[model samples]
Target: MLQRSPKDDTGDFLFHFSSIKIYNEHTLVAAPMGSGVYVRHKEGDWEGLRQGMPEDVHVNRLIIQTGKLFACTNKGLFEFDMICELWRDTGLVIGCYQLREAGGQLWAATPYGLWSRTGTGWHKIAYSHVRVYDFLFYPEFIILALEFGIAVYDRLVGVWMEFPFNEAVTGLAVFEGHILGVTENGTLLHGDKQGGFEQIRFPHLFLFSIVTKGSEVYACSDRGLFRISCIRDQITLISVRLGCPVTDIDCNADNLYMATLFQGIQRLEL
Candidate 1:
């Protein structure tokens, strides 16, 4: 069992681990914010940082690289140094939505376009005409989720191919060739890069966040949270209260971490 820390705690706020990066130290850094971020050494170890940050700013997303934490804030891009205990402002684009590491590089979703960091520089991932939301890279291709729908980035052809998703995407998670996307009105949209998309039918799930443990995919919905197997095809209720407007859902090898709008953060023993 992990001991809880006084400072590393949460109240009533939405928490979703839509993005996670594990360090060499086994410390998992998660972006639990739709408008901010935090780091924890373990459960009950929440530390509010923005320590050396210049002013009050809201960070939408974050990514970790080279033993440092990087984020796109309302002000601009920033890197957090744990050793020096300081926040270094990158001062790049001010309108960034999300960040991910792919193909030995860091990729961020900016209002301008998709920005990729290679070594010490950043170049735009040109899309003909679209605002990219979320992305996941595989050995073969890269998948991008947008407001319009879900698309795949072809590194070979240098083009984007939009998959036939007819609804707006709220959140997405990639596992192998399959991508799980949550849509409005409590529907789960899943698509395979090789095959096509197939909606997994369930009860009244509010559809907030999507998470995966091995091949088991979990969904946070208004009605409640449900866990479904990739091959077994069984939808099991995880939690009802923890499902509504759920902010962050993260796991540390064992046990579960959940953050909700009404509930600050909840830990499940199993």
Candidate 2:
């Protein structure tokens, strides 16, 4: 069963949820299309925690690293302090699309290229002209979903490589030990750091995001929520109706969270 979030600020159901992040086992934070951010604790109501944040800045993405919460917006990256319930600037003020923490370092993906944190400061690493949408972190490599193709940054060898798929990949995931790419045209592509990427034929899917829990992978698309399962040598996809387009999907231990285009948040039992 899907349950409504106890307290959503958009009483008129006009707010479109842009992104959601699982802060902890008991808390979750979400970014609305035009609002700052909202938080929900265990069995509590959703409330705004926008203090110390810029007024009317659109927050596009959220992530938690080492028990600290971070939000990427049109202005810059802001860190949320749990103790004060306030936000602090991280000083990479640009058009950031996504944020990731790998190798105990924070990485910012932007149109100006990629930036990584070293010691206490951030420095540019790669791609000044290309826009990166997502990342898949492995122990030895970081795979990026770029505007034109997939790029791999090898941490062990300190080398950069590119795989041009000629398709605009919107999302990336590591499922069953393979790098999966979700293209804007609704095709699924898989590849490894060594070999090349190949397409997986399925019904045209308008997917926006992809997430994995254990062996199961879930995708949020215009049609609904889909579960991708691989049994033996066969791949199966099952769609669940949401009656609304899903923009983002996330999961905790016991529940799956779906942020909709205009319906706020929907909680489903895991």
Model 1, stretches more than 4 Å misplaced? 1-47, 54-56, 65-67, 155-159, 164-167, 184-186, 192-195, 199-203, 213-215, 231-244
Error of 1 at 76 (Å): 3.5
Instruction: Extract clashing residue pairs from model 2.
Output: none
lDDT of 2 at 182: 86
Model 1 scores a TM of 0.73
RMSD, one per candidate, in order:
4.5, 2.8
Q: What alpha-carbon RMSD in Å does predicted model 2 have with respect to the real structure?
A: 2.8
What is the model-wide C-alpha lDDT for candidate 1? 0.61
Per-candidate count of clashing residue pairs (backbone under 3 Å): 12, 0
TM-score of model 2 (CA atoms)? 0.86
Tens-digit lDDT track for model 2 on 34-144?
888988787676778889898879886787778888888888889998888799888888867778887778998877778887876888878878887777778888788
